[model samples]
Target: MGIHIIKMPDLGEGIAEVEVVEWRVKPGDTVKEDQVLADVMTDKATVEIPSPVNGTVIALGGEIGESLAVGAELIRLEVAGSGNQNGKTATPATATATAGTTLPGSPVSTVCERAEELEEAPAPVAKAAPAQAPLLKAAPPRARGLAAPAVRQRALELGIALEFLEGSGPEGRITHADLDAQLLRRVKVAPSGPKPSDPTDAERTIAVTGMRRKIAQKMQEAKRRIPHFTYVEEVDVTELEALRAHLNGQHGNQRGRITLLPLLMRAIVLSLKQFPQANARFNDESGIVTQYDAVHIGVATQTAAGLMVPVVRNAHKHDLWSSALEVARLAEAARAGKAVRDELSGSTITITSLGALGGIVTTPVINHPEVAIIGVNKMVERPMIRDGAIVARKMMNLSSSFDHRVIDGMVAAQFVQTIRAYLETPATLFID
Candidate 1:
């Protein structure tokens, strides 16, 4: 048997390095061609590295969360016959299988290529620990219960043994409900009698890695570089809400339901026409601000992994229904970790909202390179004096932050006021 090496492919767009997020195989594990070997995180998205040839994994080039430079050795494998390694390395032409998005220049092909094109010489291979013998065979034990793949994965994550629990599913299959019941039983049988006044302090040290690490770094850099100024304004959205409800009632069956986000998006798009400065990207290092006529709105979405801002390209071209549909699709993709690199980048401005959790006021941080970010707060009805009557009005606060160096206080206020007027009227949003 001879050795074969896979190097990190050049995932274009000037990506110099990537972080190792996960490994699918270990030493001695047999992997097939096109099988994913590891997951690496770029600045935009996570990409998968797949095996080009069937082989046994022999060594991993980096540890979890380790940053690897482009063209560096990623993994080594042992194969039958005369393998590619002979004081030199055999590099796969296409080393990446992007998880959900394709890299700009890296195409998925089956052709094998030599490593001579990559100028960097191969790094010394670190010795790998001997693979441990399997404690159990491939088949499950007789006492082990039948469970779906998802259930089995969840059980592994919870550190619960399948053989210890009785199943509640059809044909004695273990379901998630069974695992929940087991957990409830354990909680009920715990020691209840209080013996001491003090309780044990427990803590978990979680490594900031993967998406979370990238988010932390980006936020830190934005806050450090940009001098941010916040502007808060209350908007009367009673008419806007009524209009949205009316439209949803009229077209709920014919078309998809509409949410307040689409209306707000419309207002933002229209408002940007008067204030182009708000819809621009600032390069502080170059001291240049580039304005765009096309409105690309980045909708900040919270996912299980972390905060991800998926962009809605050319928002000005879509109406309420189309905007709502696009927003829903992008949000779903982001939450499911399926959004592509193009959907995740190139936003001229950003919009963030917490829905019901949005407080009365928030000092939102400006998305880096973008001059402004508009934050939406929860809507509430309060008693107000309109003309001579004390009536109820739905009020919502818009908390927006702008780069003080680029946009002055008066301009930012005017920009927010423009959005407020469009939202309050609910008809001017369609005029232009």
Candidate 2:
């Protein structure tokens, strides 16, 4: 028998630490090789960490929501074999100063070296077995369902049909709110419980941790470092609307249809040809600015987790339909919490919209390091003065922000004017 200490694996480049979101296996649980032990969330994505070897878990490294540094001790395990319990052939490993002794198992030795430098520790001796605690049985047969144990128990006590109730949680997992809603719909009352005597107007506090903390830090950093200059312009998108309707009608039968965002994105790319500063990144610390040849458009999307900006690579390379499809794919992936690291960064410019909920013009913040961000406002039909008369025209405002250090007022206005021209004319967008 041998004891092995598992260290947190390197997640990715530039990732120093990760937060433990959930632990799948408990101490004393027998886990198999490659079985998921926990889900750790980094700034980029939530990744599942799998067990490196088949072993009984002795201890977890940290509690939930605790941050663990890369290469830190993650978990301790007791295994039945000498070579990581896999019985795989071991390879010779060079002894390091951190370890006075080296094991034939290269993988285990490498892991231990990274975990910590123990001072002349000898091999672990097998200990006598201890009395096992009483295992808790699962809920009654009638309480069995796809919901969590607590939700299942509540539903069973309330005589709710799990099969009939629709889940509102991620991946169709039933949430307590879903059960409550179901109960309310049927009986117009919450689950039978004692009523509170009175409600007090007390302060409620929410911990500023997790994604919210990250967002606050990033936003503060951006605002503190970048000198923001906002520009607002109203465009007559009447013709653009017509063109969009025509394109959607033609492509409506397909799996992905055209939307105003794709059209606007293409127009933005074309407009960048006139003013490339807006489609560039500025490093204030190094006093360097980089302008990219290809336009990687970042679509600012709001998800249940928080605001996520998923980039659509090579926006200039794709046609209108292709860009629309890619945008749809990236947006869906971002909202579903499946966006990859590449898709979440490296955007030359960003576009934000509230869809139909877009109110009047907004002063958008420049995405940090990126020189500019384009904000799309809701389209509404309003009275506008035409050549000879006041007419009803579909109009929308483009609220854009720029890093004043890189983009000037005249240059920013001209860039937006170019976008407006393409949107108003609709035919200019096809001009190579």
Give the per-residue lDDT digits (tens) of candidate 1, residues 4-69. 889899986778777788999987799999999999888748788899999988778766766676
lDDT of each structure? 0.84, 0.79
lDDT of 2 by residue, 205-273 (tens): 444445564566568668878999889999999998899888778777884678899889989999998
Candidate 2: give its CA RMSD in angstroms: 16.7
lDDT of 1 at 305: 85
Give residue 78's lDDT in candidate 2 (0 to 100): 75
* Number of clashing pairs per prediction, in order: 0, 0
